[model samples]
Target: METDKQQKDKQQLYTDKFFESGHWLLKIRQVLIATIGWLAVIIPIVITVLAFWASFDPRVPHLWAYHEGIYEIKFIGIILIFAWVMTLIFAVSMTIIQNRKRDRIVEQWPTFNPINQKERKKTIDDFIDKRFGPKEFRENVRSYTVKPEQNLETHQIQELYAKKDLDDVD
Candidate 1:
């Protein structure tokens, strides 16, 4: 049956694409992690350097890890730089991609059928006919006669009062 197929499709759709914590927030979190991943590398490198020099030289007057060899510092720097570059690239690219997606969603947004004068009149008439039966419907209901310049606030209150009056008459 179609219902069975639809249920199967629903189950498969979850496996096809993972939506976690809303799409935009997930994108934002990805960028944050990527950017902070670099910080994770850089901050430790800096701390290690500071701690190293402070350990040997009392004059340095700081608690810092200093790796003495130039190669070691260069290695850490290289590692930090790599982390920064990878995440920086990911962050910017993900932002642009998510922005495009956001725009697409906005562009494809659905519209609602607005309440208009004709529809409003029909809705009122039909509702009255249903509630009051034919004879009372004919006697009590009148065409909406608000001026075009009237604000929606008064129009809504007028509609509510009209419904209440009809109810009381019934």
Candidate 2:
């Protein structure tokens, strides 16, 4: 009922649709969390620098005597200031890198769902421990279900067989 060219055209359209959706989703996700990676790197480094600097001080009351000039600022102050500046640069670099990476992912695969990258692992792990998790995959293999739709196939197949097999087996 359809020509080869028509089928091919339809297929191409579908392919384009898929790619568009996938990449759109991917871009959305990369934007949301790419900075998270940079933050993870920056937060600990900043915390460490702060904690180390707070360990020592001029004691307080005689602080004015120590604050005479730049010298009172001390070696630790310089190192801390430098460290803080470096941390800022590192954080900015991380953000740029993440943004670039996200852009590339979207350009390459526009329809790739971004949510999968963030939630796939956790969803799978939870499904494994779920009520039906014990039956996930047990044929001498450790298999995790990626989505619930997978179960639909087995259910439909069983239903199809049950009607015939019920009378045939007995």
Candidate 3:
């Protein structure tokens, strides 16, 4: 049997391999997307500020001369608002779909429902007992109290104690 240290080293090796593999590409992609998203937001705000500054220039003949710049800002605002609304709608729809799917799954498998937790636990325990023989109780731990009327004769209790004493002596 492998020692605990060997088992731990094996687990650490697997974890190291998992992170060293293509997972770095996923991390890079996440950072790249986040950077691009922030740039998208920041670049527009900078442009809007510059446009406002240019619109206030006294050298410009008329206020309507910067009308295109104003229109561009308006367009960006509309796009941002539309994107936000679309994202909100997508999130709400996904939540509803997921809830319906979960409900259907729970209906199909009643054991998945929280109300049937005791039944689920009993089923798992039965499976474990069948797969591995019933788990042995710890030798010295008295998890449950044995009542006098439980049908064990005094001699049987004495024999059990005697066996425990012998084990302790060893």
Candidate 4:
């Protein structure tokens, strides 16, 4: 009942829906990255720099004092610097890992039309049949049935025979 134009519109609608969600996801990713950067990198660096500046005075005591003035390194100042370096490293490593995972997921994504899945399945089945033969083709085949321990009643035997006869007739 559908015309070519109608089919085209449906396909376009499906594709547009996919991309619309993709765009929304991208926006969310941007917001998350921005928020994480602020919390992890920017805030740490700011705090570290403030601590360093505040403790840069002559009154502040040093952990290991060698020379006076600019040469002195306070214990708290060293800790803040180390923390800032670690924060930067953590942010960069997390970004790299996230990007690699995103790439892997995108690469592994399946592309299939939900509307025409049966047709697609048929095409795949046909390819498999041509390449590997029918579903009945197999290396090892077995036929096994579970039997009751006691002997069946006479009626049960007659029913089994009747079922076999029906199968033969078919």
Candidate models: Cα lDDT each:
0.65, 0.58, 0.65, 0.59
Better of 2 and 4 by lDDT: 4
Model 4 segments beyond 4 Å from truth? 1-73, 110-170
List ranges where model 3 is wrong by over 4 Å: 1-48, 53-66, 82-120, 136-170
What does candidate 3's lDDT look like per residue over 1-170, in tens digits?
99988887874434443356578777787789999999999997776676666677866444343687777777888999999999999999999999999889866765434554565456546554554345675244557555455454556533543543421222
Pairs in clash, predicted candidate 3: none
Instruction: Compose the digit string of candidate 1's lDDT tens values, residues 27-79.
Output: 77778999999999999778766666666677875753444564576678899
lDDT of 2 at 34: 75
The candidate, 1 or 3, that scores higher on TM-score is: 3
- Model 1 spans > 4 angstroms off: 1-68, 111-170
Clashes (N, CA, C under 3 Å) per candidate: 8, 7, 0, 0
For model 2, how does the per-residue alpha-carbon lDDT over 1-170 read when each residue is reduced to its tens digit? 99988887874334443346467776767766878888999986666545445445444233223333335446668899999999999999999999999888867874634544445445545544463445435444565556665454545533543543421223
RMSD (Å) per prediction: 19.6, 22.4, 17.3, 19.9
Extract clashing residue pairs from model 2: 21-111, 22-110, 22-111, 22-112, 23-110, 23-111, 23-112
State which candidate, 2 or 3, has the greater TM-score.
3
Candidate 2 wrong stretches, greater than 4 Å: 1-73, 107-170
Which candidate wins on lDDT? 3
Count residue pairs with overlapping backbones in model 1: 8
